[model samples]
Target chain A: MDLDLDAATLDFRGEVRGWLAEHVPRPGLPSMDTAEGFAAHREWEATLARARLSVVTWPREYTGREASLVQWLVFEEEYYAAGAPGRVSQNGIFMLAPTLFAHGTAEQRDRILPAMARGEQVWAQAWSEPEAGSDIAALRSRAERTDGGWLLSGQKTWSSRAAFADRAFGLFRSDPSSSRHHGLTYFMIDLRADGVTVRPIPQLDGEPGFAEIFLDEVFVPDADVIGEPGNGWRVAMTTANNERGLSLRSPGRFLAAADRLVDLWRQRGEPEWAAERVADAWIGARAYQLYTYGTATRLAEGGQLGPESSVNKLYWSHLDLGLHETALDLLGADGELAGPWTDGYLFALAGPIYGGTDQIQRNTIAERLLGLPREAR
Target chain B: MRFTPSPEQRQFAASLHDLLSGADTPGAVRAWAEGRPEPGLKLWRDLADLGVTALRVPEECDGLGAGLTDLVIAFEVLGYHAVPGPLAESVAVAPALLGDGERLRALAAGRLLATVALPPHVPYALDADVAGLVLLVENGAVYRGEPETEPVRSVDAARRLFRVAGTGGALGATDGSAFEAGVLAVAAELLGAGQRLLDEAAAYARQRHQYGRPIGSYQALKHLLADVVTRLELARPLVHGAAVTATARDVSAAKAAAGEAAYLAARAALQVHGAIGYTAEHHLGLWLTRVRALTGAWGGGAYHRARVLAGA
Candidate 1:
């Protein structure tokens, strides 16, 4: 019920505001999918790592500030408000870090987290295969038990960040006899290992934002296995929730976009019929910001992250798309030209498709949150 | 900072739910729509005994003197039950305007029912004939209004609207806090109404069969209802947040979101219920039409959005 921040949170917010104001790059960074931009974005992550801002919620030993979730949210708000560069280590920092903290061993955390925080080991996700888009449990990737580790052999399409990321993580079929979410093992695999081939795919924006990771027999050490071997389904479920939840997409990003959209509307002479849409963007963003604060508070109160995460995913993805579309509508004829607005609009298209498609997220909300009848697959 | 409801707030809402659940609210609403205010007024008296109408009245006025958050908590439950009356007017607007007086105490004690017409924002006095007091707000001035006029039928049959005319000198000066409180109060009602619609739609989907299976098992209807729940869930926090902050910017944002979310719920519920929901005899129409009425009651989406644009 209380919305006022404590003194410590306010102080932490002031510190983050000052740091972001001074260090955030002017003119912003290029797309992290490109080679030069990837290197530049990686350097930016290293700079943030030195300041312990790269992973604000991680342990201090891993270059994090040991910040509470509220402070982490404040950091994100300031980070986006300052127009900071995209996180080059987001795959590991946002997605895998939480899973590792929850399911990986202490040794795995000590070994992997510090490097990830420092941007020394960038990671991509190898979840969706050509045949296993939304129904990710249908993945055909197999892992055979070897002398010291497991040998992975499968093709993973839409492997985000694999175009330049150092390592990737995915679920693997380990028992050979089981299928469909059974006997699967979660593994962190090196992209540069022998028999691994990364074929970069140009997105609609003509950037290698994602790739296809083909593996003949990529070796992953036993230390890389997350949770129990057969319980990979359970472990991967956590990652799915994280991917679709507040970790991957906080309301800060949308709030920032909303501010930018409002500015755009003013700059464009406030076109008719666009006022409602533009204002709607602001409304949706504020609603989302408040919604996430509630979510963070619930999580802090020891609430479990469940299918409610899909609610966040479903809400923001549509909001993001609508915001960008509003920006384009404000641009009018210039909207057709390939520019930042167009680039953002194209990127927002992925919002509905990735991190579990909106349709899939909606189904999760209906069945899990509302206790509706499950779809007869 | 925390945005979740407190234990007391949760308990208050639960008690309201308990009382309203047994109040036979549908029958009361039907009576009120037919100009028989006895059933609805009886429920109002019971709610007042529970201190529902006294949430915003100051302590000196013999009331609880609670904050806007508490008012919204009460209003939300009232909307969930589809309670018929000048609820926002009596509980929120009246208390905010005519503070620390016998009128306020009377409202707090449920001895009086009131309605107001604030020009531009609220041009019509809702349920004016049944009200013990009808007021007009114009140019920061509050005046007594004549309410025994021709009735203007509202979208929701239970809401009796009258074009109230200002008849006397200013009773007092207002800083327009009443309108702001009314905005947030109406937003909470819209959110609750939408939530009820979503819940009913979900329940219907669970039982209503189509093609040898529950219609909820169909992806098309399921996805439609799912989107409705997402919007309503996100909108819920906005109303709660605005209630806590009570800022003009936050209030507008809350109203805009709740209005749109409620309309979406109404549409999705009607689509799910098909022809049955379209019938006035069905209870779903109460929530559905109440949502439609409340979305534009205090400040329409466009007006609120303009406020948001101005503040943003």
Candidate 2:
């Protein structure tokens, strides 16, 4: 097992490092959840797209450089290490992009991918409804087949970035007779559609981080339907896996935070009581980095991600929470104030709740990874 | 870069697993604790023949000249089967310490056995009665010694500990890297032990029923075992990664993580197995005790944490 970057990866890393060094904002942009900050992050994404750094792993046809997974990870490391702004287009770039690449038709890829890569049409997930959170298959959203398209009616809550996003992608029950997983249709709907309503939901940090999307007979063309009409469940699984895996949360983010945490600790004269906790945060981040490297290596070697994605989700969620918690603890009384650490801590708290809750993740790990008996439904 | 083991490394571990699986390791462990070292020695010789003892030794020293990653793989299997020996010393530590010495060749060839005492934490040599050589490490120096043995009982019966009292000629200055190697090897063992506990607990959870359902179906036990599995799986990358990047900080981080993971697994295993697991008759107790002893073996969590913090 080797950890050293190969020559090509090193070259890619050098290129990314050089580009980020030159282009990363001198003073970092404000929180991407804020309206002004969202615009700034969108501009940053445009800047990255111009350099073909926005979606390094996508094919050149999609305005990308067709980088390898290792290269993408290296790019992410460099991106975070450079203190670059958070990706305002992450819901599009990370969540929907992979699903589009995997299941989208040629026309869909041609239309949606470039817009996503260029940050021209930011996307948000419209998966969870008010009635359906963890049990997404129990969603009551319906998509009635009309003449050449489907008329959708649903209320999706906790739709991240939906407040300002141009489009959303989610599953809608296409057949009235079918329930649970079958007869569901995955659709990419315009948030500005005739019957669409977007209501921003203020997050714990008092920002419109996510929104509630109300779709009342919103028409989506058949071409916007991803995968097969009755195969949305299968299609959505790809997005779900990506959400829990490398796409949404890269180890680079935590490693950078851990580095910041260590710096904070050092600044505090290295209090002996907090030393182990600080050390643990760093070690945990390193473990995650190595673990992601392992996962990337496995994926590169043609291994499919299964329930192990749940394991990755649980690990990173806790790691992020713990890293930020330690940072705040090191901050002492000042931690109570609204600063980077406190803000980050608030965001970290959302990690376990989103992408799927820790409880759901644990259940998945137990049932799928450990071969435990599923509870009686 | 490939962070996972190569096929050959996996095959090596698999073969070791097969051999240990058939060796009646629990019986051997019992015999060792009963002061009958023959069975454990025979098992150790079998492992030695597999070139486990020779892995870290240089090829010029009549050994495999393998890296720490290979030793990590071998040591993991040894821990999985709960193999009884000074494995870290003979397979990892002593090889790095002694290098191409005449005794090193014998040790690699399974002709001789060795134990070590790196005071003040490890002032006692384990299985010293069966060892043909003993090395005492102190203050960056290594010395040959014949210990005046006072038997010290460990929580794990298989570990025959001894307090050494002797002085001898210095062999050479001890390399700090040897200690780090030892820690990494022990970490691998802890990872293995943790895995075994998880496996045993999972199996028991499936079979053992309570309140009209299998205990595994209960969310409490399920979450507990799941957490154990998560910790073990995460600790694995740390151990293997530390093997590749053998820095003091990396090794210490690995040791700390592996130790805590193993300790968690031990606790969870016992809790899942209930009263049966606490009894010595049950094989789960073997790993439980082994995990406890090994958690504080090379350097405890506090020591490794301090090392990581200092290095950070």
Candidate 3:
């Protein structure tokens, strides 16, 4: 297998490198979890959209370059390497946009994608309820048929970015008799609709990084339904796979972190105790990058992602946690204080718990990929 | 850039796998351990006839003229079969060290067998009794030697290790690439061994019943095997990527990752097999011991980690 980027990819890299160098916000935008920071990040996203750099792999009509997946990876590498601000609209642009392109009707795409790309409408995932964190199919959220739309009634907890997001998309049981992945309808709901409430939840770093969304008979127009009604389970799997796969946690972020880790180790006089761990972190990141390139190649060759996404999710979760843990270990006593390392460590702790808990991911890997028997439900 | 193996490479691996599946590799491994090397050597010749021995040798030397990536694919299949030989030395390292020589031609043609002792890290020669040639590498210099040897028992019975004494005239000066190739070969082998362990354990878990159901249904067993699967899957790309790059740092990184992943798989496999895996009669023990032996074969995890950190 060849590791060298083609001339076209190299040229794309140069273009993205040049553009990001010039337009990436200096001093970086503030963390997007806070309300003010959210507004600033949204503005930054608008600037990116204006420059047609918000979604490099999407169609040009959606403010993208229609770039190849390899070029998109290159763009991510340059973006993270430049120390750019995190995407405030990632939940929309990365997770939802792909699902929309794949399953949304043409009208839905026209109405939602460009706005999402421009950061005019930020999205949050509303899949997990208080009782349905990992076993999401056990969710009791219901969307009942109404005259012109459906009335959504449910509670969705751990809805990341929901506190500031304009809308949310999730699965609701549309058929009263259905249970466990059956007869669910995927709907996009306006957070500002009547009978909806969003309560910001303080995370480990004391930021409102997630929120609890309560829908009490919130009316959603039929136009907002993604894919056919009563087939939400199949439709939502695309978004879940995206969440756990390459689109959400690109290897660029980890590679950038690894570089920073090496720099930290060098600055700390290369402490003997931390050296192996530092090397391991770097190696893991490199392995992930190569694996992702392989995956991108496979997808480009028309392969579909399946249970293998669970493997990726399990890997990056641990890699992220380990990288941050090593950074803290190098920081020593100062790591106890509030800093980027400490903040990142706190965030990394959430990796294994979100998108699907590690336990659930393990089960998926075993039952699906390995052809093992399913455990008792 | 393509990261997965090409279709041609996959076909080669599949062919090798078919041959090994029918080769009675376990019997050959046992025969070798019992000091009957003829059976194992016969299988090795069969592999050589498949051009496994000639992969990394240059075309000028009457060899296949393939790259390290091809050697990695061959070595991984050999590891999966637990093939009993100094495969890394004969197939990968010796070609890099003895490039274009008559001895290289003989080695590639399967007319000779070679074993190496690279000092500091690899102070012992493996299968020197069966080898037609023995080489010593010290401080970047290669020397032809018929050094005195003292037997050292290995955890893997299929492997016969010995400490060498006395060095002969210098053959040539070489860079670190040969050593790095050796490391990458071992990493590939470790990846294969880990994959085998995962496969065996997964199959066993599917059939072995406990608590009135297959053990595979238990989360404990499922999670254990799943962890191994993830480690092996992630480590594989590193092995292939290292073969592509063949730099010291890349090779060392591959070795470190493959070694750890394989060791973890061994542990998980034994755990999943329960008492049966501990018995000598089971083929699982053969792979278990082989993985243990290979984990520190070229260089242990700590050494590879230091190499990676040193940016070598």
i-RMSD values for every candidate model = 1.0, 0.8, 1.2
TM-score of candidate 3 chain A against the true chain A? 0.98
- Looking at model 3, residue B135 earns an lDDT score of 84
Off by over 4 Å in 1: none
- Residue B51's lDDT within candidate 1 is 95
Q: Write the per-residue lDDT of candidate 1 for residues B71-117, one digit (tens) a residue.
A: 88888888889999999999999988885499888999999999999
Q: lDDT tens digits, residues A84-143, model 2?
A: 888989988888888888998899999888988888898888989998999988999999
For candidate 1, report its TM-score. Answer: 0.98
Candidate 3 lDDT over residue span B1-312, tens digit each: 888899999999999999999989999999998778998999889988888888888888888989888888888899899999888888888888885479878988888888898988888888888888888888888887564555688999889987776366788877978888888889999898888988999999999998799999999998998898888888998899988988888888899999999999999999999999999999999899999999888989889899888882
- What local lDDT score does residue B257 receive in model 2, on the 0 to 100 scale? 98
Q: Write the per-residue lDDT of candidate 3 for residues A1-377, one digit (tens) a residue.
A: 87889998899889878988898887777779988999999998898889888998989888888998888988899889988888989889878888898899899999999999899999988888989988999999999999889999989999999989999989999999999999999999999999999999998778899999999999999999999999999999998888888888899999999999999999999999998899999999998998999999899999988889999999999999999999998988887988778877888999999999999999999999998999778
Q: Is 1 or 2 the stronger prediction by lDDT?
A: 1
Query: Model 3, A68: alpha-carbon shift in Å?
Result: 1.3
Top candidate on DockQ is 1
